[model samples]
Structures are given as structure tokens and as C-alpha cells.
Target: MSEAVPLPAGTTLGKSFEYGIDINLGTSAVPEWQPFRRISGFQPTFTPTTQDAQTYDDLGADNSDVTGWSFAIAFNVQVNRNTATGLYLPEIEALLARTRPSAKGEAAVVEVRWYHKPEIGTPNPADAGQGRATVAITRQNTGPNGEIEVLSVTLSGKGPYTEIANPFDGWDSTVAVIGTVGPEGAGDGDLVTITGTGFLGTTGVSIDGASLAATDYTVVSGATIIAALPAGDAGNVPVIVTNAAGASAPHTFTRGA
Candidate 1:
């Protein structure tokens, strides 16, 4: 008999709703990540810290510096019966155990992996992996729906989430937009944050072709920037951040009327 050979499945990349999360709870015997079951949706949030740099002579456009950033993820995982391990109890146990206060009342760190490509057959690049050190579990609740038990968990990042990139990816010279948080669509004068890497010394952030004024945006750091969406027609526009390194790949920002 011939050995079984792997074949390409020709599967399409799925959306965030289709993806799932894997968590590493240090005490577990299995070093392997335990996958969360029946994930309805996974959402990431990025908030940038900025203070108004507007001067008296300026129009008070809210120009600011990118001081720092924080990240969090919110998602729902269903409570399904696992015949072998019993109804996601292990996950619940891990969650409870890791989040419990210690003798000194110190919180534990929970590592999470938000896999962009949830499909097991495809290879996930390190850069695509979102590594978060969860410092706290802000909220958890069950029974949001009619009768089904669903766990809604929110994990706050201990620090800025890191996406390890390959050396050949030109990580040093390129801008990478990892995610955007807050409102999916904003109106004119609304503030939104662009989170990623290589954001230091950003010269400008453009929506479509129009560059935002200096007073309208702030470079929080090399990893974050808070920019107020400029006045524009309601629709989806390409957002590009340019610096001495180079211009980053465009991410869409919708401006509502």
C-alpha cells in the first residue's frame, strides 16, 4: 500500500467570525494549546493614548503624540459537551485557575493566540499570529442567548501584542497595520486609533488621497497613532500611514455621514 499523501484542499480564507482562539494555561499537562469550542465571534480592540498638542495659535485640531497603546479581545465560546473531557470544563477550569489571585494577590498571565487562519491545513505565518499576554479577565458571563450556555470572555493585554515577523519580510523598512479598534465607522471629527508596527516618525496619515493635518493626528509611538477622521463623504476610504521607513499597506476606514 502507498503512504497517504497530503493534497491541497483549495480552501478560502475565512473571516474573523469563522476563526477561533487557542489559549496556553501554564499548569496544563498538555503543553499544546486547547482550542475554544463553538466560537461565535472574535473581536480585537486597540486603544492609543494621546494628549492634545494643539497650541493657542492653532484651531484646536487635537494634534497629539502617540504615547502608548493597549489591546483587548472579546469573544463568545459555546459550552458544548466534550465526551472525553466533559463540556469545556477544562477550559473553564483553566480560565478560573489562571485568573485566580495568588497568595500575594498578584494576577497571573494568560497567553492567547488569535489565529487569523483558523483552518488547520494552511500554514500560518508568525507575523500573522497575535501573541497577547492577558493581564486580566475583565468580564465573563453565560446564558446571553435563550437557553444555550455561551461564555463571553474579555481579555486585556498586559502590554502591546507582538506579531513576530520573518527577517525577509522587510519588517524594519515596512509598515504593518495589525488591527483597528473602536467604531467600525466614524463621522467627521471622530477619533480612531491605528495599531501596528513601524509607526514612528509618521509624516502623515491619508484617507484616500487627502493627508490629515498635523493638528488632527498624533503619533503615539512606533506601534500606535490616534487620528481624527477628516471631513469626507460617507463611504469606505483607504487609510495609509507614511513615515521615513515607507508607506504601509492601506487599511479601509469607513466615514459615516
Candidate 2:
């Protein structure tokens, strides 16, 4: 292959051939069996501020040349189109007075995916925290009746966050309000159906504590607590389910008659 310039001396060597070949290429990086993660920062927020939440940061480095076990994080995300469609939990709220001298502790939940179509669009991933972060995230909505709302929520970019914002507070998940205990061995009032769990504005019902002016009962999802068998006597009866963010700790039922 003598330098690429002049080559026509004798014009007769003998044989020159490059047999059996096919070519097609286009690759820079991100393919070695693909399996890597290490995200230590990310903070995106927008809950009705005319949609605009940007400024990102990331961290992660451990290649050992090729593979010895690697963790990685690289970030730059902020999608704004008034961002809000539900499920944006980024609570790996780092608590690192962390002085990892060399190595002996690791909190891993490295997963970052951000996709929002607004041009060159298509990047959707909202989940950060597997080792523990207040698990902060919520921007949910789904059409009609009371019209659910939550649009734009992402917070977990490592802290001692002296306080840009810290303290994840959200209550609307009381899960447990079921009813079906009537006319069998009956003890108190016997008119059953007091399913309760954060029973939204549920004015009254009391079994073993005895305070029932009586209303029939039907509350389904402040975490359910349905009652209607107050003539008690079968064993295991401690029923307590109230709301306004209060009573919920006596959910045991076994008094059928």
C-alpha cells in the first residue's frame, strides 16, 4: 500500500485481490451488551407555572476500561409544554454526609429516562430512587368528573438540600374500605355496610367504642372501612376507620352474627 501518490512503475506484479467482503457501518457508542446505571442528580418541576421546568445535573463514572461493574449518570433534561400528564416520581433524595473514604457502601437506584416531544421529541422516563428518596413525584390527570389534576413534578437532585424545596406531602391514597358483614349471628344494631378508609367527610360510625347514630355507611378509598354488624360476639372485633386524616387502626373482622 506504498503511500497514496504514484504507483505505476512496472504495471505487473502478479496477483491483487480482496475476496469475500461486505461493509455497512454507523456506530459511536452505547453497545457492549448494554447494561449500565448511576444517576445522582435531577430536578425538574412544573405544576402550573405556565409550564417551564429545566436545568439538570448528573453524575456517574466507573468503566474500569470495559467492565468490572459500572455505575453511571449523565443528565440534561427539562421538558416544557406546560408539562403534566401523570407519574413523575424523582425521589432518590440523596442523604450523603457521605464521605466514602474508599468503598463500603452503595445506594443504587440508577435509572433516568426523560422524553418529551416538542421537537426531536420522544424521551419518556420518570423514576429515580431505589435506595430511598422521599419518592416525590405526581402530575396525574385523566378526564371527566372532579377532573383529576397533577402536572409536572420531579425532585431529587441530591441533598442536604439546604432547602430549594424539601418535604414531600401528598395525601389522597387511603386504600382500604370494604363492607359485607350482616345478618348471621348478629349482636348490636345489625344493618351492615360501613366500608371505611379516609372515608371523605364520613360524619359517623362506632362499633366497639359505641358512637353510632346510624347512616348505613358507604366509603370506598381513604383505605376502606365498612361497618354494620354492631351487636358483636364472635371474637376479633376492633373496627376503627375515620377520616379528615385521622382514625384507622382496628381493622379486624370476625363477628358475623
Candidate 3:
């Protein structure tokens, strides 16, 4: 969290839709969450479910019921021009491309978040609210002469869209990512350094289900650990970390052949 700057009196700053936003989307069973990049515009709407309660004979008993709600968000996605792909188009395509006929591939809910300040700026109180919904590509229009190319994406949700929650509040899930493992394809008797977070007081670590002895690993800090690869067959194996908090999602480590 960064220090908050005071806003001047009577000053109104328009929200900048250029950056500081993320969109997470995946299936109902497994969510391959990813943040959106190169976004240009965003608009969200909410709709409520209603039901009639008035009887035909009772005009004075006129009534209606509001039972549930839903929501939608519309936004513009930008495409970069270059010999190679830019920062975002490829990732966006990966998600949208999942809408296939087979059961193995299909579109699912998307989680969207917006940060009013620059992404690198200190975190503010308004930085954590998010919405989730199924998305649809509404239109594609090349911007006016001087503007960048863009795609209009609209996401909608039905049957009880949930209320936005502060993702950082009471967030207990341990999200550990293997940023790098030196000697990436090392063999037995080789030592490796794994760098990541939420590693304080690590209880155990394993490679391919073979537990490494205490002497084999050292908890360098809350963000790092050093361990030796157990002697085993050459192949790819999962690396698991366990602590008082819980086990982290398995990360793949390839062993030398």
C-alpha cells in the first residue's frame, strides 16, 4: 500500500479508463484467471428481477416484488500493431478462443477489477472491488483516424449476480508462483533455489512426491527457499510446498534426462 495523496477541495478527477484494470475469466470447474491488458474503456450496469403481486380484483392492493439481480459490463480492448505480438492481445485471444463446441472447451465467468490510480501507484481504499460475469464480443470498430484499433466487449451475468467484495479482505488463499528455479533442468544431487512468497516457516517441500529431508532445504525468508532435487528418474515432476497455512498449488519442475 502506498501513501494516499490528499485531494484538493472542489476538485473532480475523471476516472481514467486507459489502464489500472484487470479481468479474470475461466470455466466453472477450473478458473484460469488472467488480468486483461491494453484496455481503453469500461461501463457497468445492474438490473434487478421483479415480480407482480397484485390480485386482479384488488386495485388498492397493487404491489410488486423485487427478488434478485444481475449485471453487465461493457468495455473496449486495444490491439497493438507490430511484427510480433505486443503486451496483451495474445492473452485475450487465449480466453476468448476457449469457446469451443467440445465439453473440454467453453467460455465462463469473468472477474473484472479497476484501479483509479496508476497501477504502480500506492494502493487506495477503492482498489479492490470486482465483478464477475460471462462475456460476449459485441462489436469491433477501428478507432477514428488518429485513435488505436479496439474491440468492444460486453460481459453479462444472470440468475443472482453476486455483490462485489474486496478481494484483499480476509483473503487467506496462499498463491505461490515459481518465479524461477536455478538449474531449471538439473539432475539428482543438484541444489536449486526457488523464489516466491508466503513461505515463512515452511514445514516440508517435495519433488515428484519424494519428500526432501530437513537438511535438504532451508527457508530463506517469506519469499524464498533452497532445496536439493532428490535422486530420481529424468522427467517433469510437481514441486509442492506445505506450511502451517496449508499446501500451495503444485508447480512443475523439469528434471534433466
Q: For model 3, state the Cα shift of residue 85 in Å.
A: 6.4
Cα error, residue 93 of model 2, in Å, equals 10
lDDT of 3 by residue, 148-256 (tens): 6676788765445443222221125364555666667799889888888666435568889987776688666556788988888887788987764567788888887
Q: Over the stretch 1-257, how does candidate 1's per-residue lDDT look in tens digits?
A: 87977556775555555455667554222233456667766787889988778788777666788888888888876666668866555666566665655612224566666644443433333423345554434334535566666667788787787663211122245655636633666888899888887664355688768887755777665577788887888888888887645687888776786
Q: lDDT tens digits, residues 80-126, model 2? A: 22238443222212211112233233332122222221112111112
Deviation (Å) of 36 in candidate 1 = 1.6
TM-score of model number 2: 0.20
Q: How good is model 1 by TM-score?
A: 0.46
Candidate 2 displacement at residue 162 in angstroms: 30
Order by lDDT, highest first = 1, 3, 2
Give the residue spans of candidate 2 off by over 4 A: 1-94, 99-103, 106-234, 237-249, 255-257
Instruction: Report the Cα lDDT for residue 110, model 3.
Output: 53
Best by the lDDT measure:
1
C-alpha lDDT of residue 105 in model 2:
36
> What Cα-based lDDT does every candidate model obtain?
0.63, 0.33, 0.61
lDDT of 1 at 66: 81
Clashing residue pairs in candidate 1 are 66-219, 66-220, 67-220, 82-87
